[model samples]
Target chain A: MISSIGRFIIGVFSSTGGVVILFLRTLYWVFIGPFQKKPVKLESVFYQMGFTGLRSVLIVFFVAIFTGIVLAMQTAYQLEKMGAVLYVASLVAISLCRELSPVLTALVVAGRVGSAISAELGTMKVTEQIEALEIMAINPVRFLVVPRFLALFFMLPCLTILGNLSGILGGFLVGVGSLNINPYLYLQTSFKYLELKDIYTGLTKSFVFAILIALVACFEGLNTTKGAEGVGRATTRTVVISFILIILADCVLTSIFYFSNM
Target chain B: MQRDYSQEAIISVRGVSKEFDGRKIIDNVSFDIYCGETFVIMGCSGSGKSTLLRLMTGAIKPTEGSIIIKGKDISKLRTYQLDELRKSFGMLFQYSALLDSLTVEDNVALPLREHTKLDEEIIKIIVKMKLSLVGLRGFEKYYPSQISGGMRKRVGLARAIALDPDIVFYDEPTSGLDPVVGGVIDKLIKDLSEKLLITSIVVTHDMQSVFRIADRVAMVHKGKLIQVGTPQEIKNSENPYIKQFINGLPQGPIDFFKEDIGILEEFI
Candidate 1:
């Protein structure tokens, strides 16, 4: 029993070390990879961006708009009782800009894009395609992982911004059409309580979440074993691990940014 | 069965051993493969043939000793240096390993596009030429999934020889095919070896494939090489293990059952 517990601890540490090494290698390849004979293909990066960002726009838009509407409905009810219903706009905007849009966008991507990355790569691993790449002198990390990494890094913030705007519009619609609040007053109050720092904080969190999702997905995919069943397990693990790490990162960064603002 | 010393040795495995989880997969084994010859490594399923092939290709490092390709120890080379070395080698996997995302032409053109500065027209011509060489000329626009298994393997071969590599490695080149299709693949392997003068190393258990293409055959048994000789020499070998493997014998020195000490004592 003691030996089994020791083995479990060792397994966790070694796995953590493996992920760290993969992260470092990815960063090194990103900066120094262009000078290599087989540089990261720009076409591949563009393709990844299209898939991870452009294809995902409609889903993110709809989700964000709904979240805004729900936030306004809940907060407006309580604020109406206190004769401060105008504050619902501020509440929705603050939640969307400072927290909801980034976190929710990341969660959506972790479920959709992260799972796809893991499954695709895991299939490649089992099929000996990854080995074939190594045999051909191609760095799989540079060839496969870097493009996804850059795509997520460049697109997540843009998606978050789009989501934030859609969310505010949703809140505005709710205030004016449903609650009979003045449109001008709702618009004014939405920006009245929000600042550039809030937007910046959300975008920063998004960028970190992008890295977390990409790294975990690629790492799990590359380490996949046992064939088809293994790919399924890796895809599932990518989603679960990305959720845990993204939330943890969000908490830590929020704390730091909150303290700094104070 | 005497080796031709005049021909240059392209790859030399010197006392190589490989282990996994404290279990030895390849024991101390050494052999030299000459340039422009088809060397076949043959064994039963659990005999570590694939592991040995991977070690020679520098896809995996050995646990001990060295695999020297062109006088460079592959085990000692850094990751980038290994990548540089790998440019001279191409490998066709068992399932063909074609990128499902890329069309056949794109797959064949991958090496040239990545490693060379040739213009699009030049790459197109080269892609056509490579495809034609493997009889995949008009199937350029098809994805791997759209093609039959044999056609996919042919496409894989076209891609493997894309950069005009000095060497090509094939893993189970003829497995999962009917006899007629298998013969066609064997002919292609021979044709490529003769025409391109590229050194070929094939890992397979197919006896017919072994005799049809191999200039020299290495028979592996339980992670050790039992014999290395010409195909004719291998067929004539008196080694019981080789006899069993070659003839597909049900009973020989290769025991089918693993008996405990007590079980063996009872039998005695």
Candidate 2:
């Protein structure tokens, strides 16, 4: 049992190391490889942006809007006891910007886009398409991973912003139409309570989540073994690991922001 | 068109051995493949023939010795250097390894677009010419999944020759095809080697393909080079493993199931 535990620990460390190396290589290709005469294909990056970002909008909107409505109703239930039910607008706005929308959008993208990336690359790895790329002297990392990394790096923040607006809109509808709060007052309360720091802090968290999702997905993908079974395993592992890492990273970033009074 | 002994060796494998988890997949194997000739490495499954092909392709490094391709020691070349060297070589995988996301024309045009600065028109023309050479005309817009297995293999051949590589490596080029398609591929391989005068290194277990396409044949059994000779010479070889492998005899010195027979006896 002790030896098996030890083996597990070693495996985790080794794979973590692999992920770090892959992340750095991707960063190099994205930032430095272009100047070295091998530019990342712009069309491919745009294609990935469409797949990972545009296609994910509807799911993010639904998740964020529902969460927003739930938050407003729950907060109104509490604040109504103190005759401060109008604070529901402020509560929903602050919470969505500072925490909910970014995290929820990330989880959604991690499920949709992250799993797809792993499955696609894992299939390619097992099928020798990756090896074929390498034999052709096209670095698979540059050809496959960099555009994905760039897409998530830029698009996840945009999705989080979209989610933020959608969620705020949901809260507005609940506050003005159902809760009998004045529409103008609800808007004012939301704006008054939502700080620039809150919005930026949330966006920052999303950027970090984007990195985590892209790296975890691509790392698991390129390291996939066996065959069809391995592809399935890698896909599952990408989703699981991305979810864990996004949450863990959110915790660390939130604690830092709270301590620094951001 | 025959085996050219006068030409210099273009690819040299010297005392190469590959190990995985302390298990030798390829023993100290050494051979040289002459320029512009068809050399086939024939072996049963799991005999390290595919691994040998990968080693030559620089996909994996050998644990010992070196692979020298076209006068450059491939094992010592850096990534940039390796990429530069690889531009001159093309490989056809067992499954063709065409990018599923790309169309047939794009697959053939990939190496050209990546490695050359040709215009779109020029690249399209080149793609058309290469596809025609492989007899895969009018399939340019189809994805890999939409094509038949034989057609996919031909497209793969078209893609492999897109860059007009000096040498082409084929890993089990005729493994899963019907005999007619296999024969067609064999003819294509022979024709490409002769017409293009490109060195062709093929790894396969099919005896028919070996006799049909190989100017020289190397027999590998259990990670070792059993014999390397002309097709006629290999057919007439007296080596037990080679004879057993070629004759498909169950009872020979080349038995692979010796390690687990007691388990079968126990079950029986």
Candidate 3:
């Protein structure tokens, strides 16, 4: 038992080290590689943007809008007794923007984009494609991982913004459609308590979440061994680890935002 | 089977050994490969020839000793230096390893696009030329999955020669193909060696290929060099292991079931 626990601890440390090295390598390629005659291709970055951001709009909308509706209904249930049901709009809008939208959108993207990247890279690793790239003098980290890293870093924040808007719309539907609240009053209440900092804080969390998803996914993919089984395992681990890190980061950021009054 | 010593050796493997998890996969093995020669390394599946190929490619570092390509010790080079050296050679994987997402033309043009400042139209012409050299003309629009296995291998050959490198290493070039297609690939390897003056190192267990392409052949068994000679010399070799391997005999000094020790442990 002790030996197994020791092994687990060592595994964690080594993998953490691996991820840090990958992160540093990606940063170097993005910022410094261009000056050294190794520019990152804009075409590759745009292709990745289409995959991560454009293709993901519908799923994010569905998830965020539904969460918004459920949230509005639940808050109104208790607020109805207090005769303050109008606060439901403000509550859903604030919570979704400050926490739910960023975390939820990241989780969805982590499931969709993160798993695909890991599985793709894992298959390449096993099949000698990555090795082929290496033999051709192409740095796999620069060629394969950099565009993906930059795409997630920028696009996740945009996705979170979309999620924030859809969620507010969902809450508005619940507030004005069935709850008999005036549409104008619902809009007023929603923005009355909401601040610019709330949306930006969520966007900030998304940027952090983007780093986590890209690093963990690419790290897992690049290190895949064995064969198809290894690729499947890497994909699963990417999703699980990204979800954990997203929630963990959200919790920490929330506390900091709360305590600092920013 | 005597070889002319006039040509200097381009690749020299010196007492290289590779170990994995405390187990030696490639024992101390040394050999010299001359410039513009097709040297075949043949061994059974678990015999570590693939590991040696990877070591020479600088994909993995050796546990001990050195691999020198054109007198520069590959083991000692920095990452960028190694990459610089890597651009001087190309490798063809058993599975072809073409990027599945790219069309055949894009795959062939990848090396040029990444490493050259050539115009797109110039690259397109070069891609067409390389594809035609491998007898794969007009198949440029197809992805790897859209082609036959034999065609994929030919496209892989086109990709390998895309950079016009001094050395080309092939892993199991004809492992899964009809005998006729295999002959075509074998012919390509020979033509590339003689016509392009390219040094070719092929790793395979296919006896037919060994005899067909190699100017000098090396047989490895259990991670150790058993014999190195011309096809005729290897055909006439008295070494029991080589004789057994070449003949595909069931009875010999080479025990077939000894490899099952690890598999048996897995079950128990």
Q: What does each candidate score in C-alpha RMSD?
A: 2.5, 1.2, 2.4
lDDT for each residue of candidate 1 in A112-133, tens digit (9 for 90 to 100): 9999999999999999888878
Chain A only TM-scores, each candidate in turn:
0.96, 0.99, 0.99
State in Å the error of residue B80, model 3: 0.7
* Model 1: colliding residue pairs: none
DockQ-based ranking, best first?
Answer: 2, 1, 3
TM-score top scorer: 2
Q: Higher-DockQ candidate among 1 and 3?
A: 1
Report how large a share of the reference interface contacts model 1 reproduces: 0.86
User: What total of clashing residue pairs does each candidate reach?
Assistant: 0, 0, 0
Candidates 1 and 2 compared by lDDT, better number: 2
Which regions in candidate 2 have their CA more than 4 angstroms from the true location? B258-268
Stronger candidate by lDDT (2 vs 3): 3
Q: List the residue pairs that clash in candidate 3.
A: none
- lDDT of each residue in B85-126, candidate 3, tens digit only: 988898889999999889999999999999999999999999
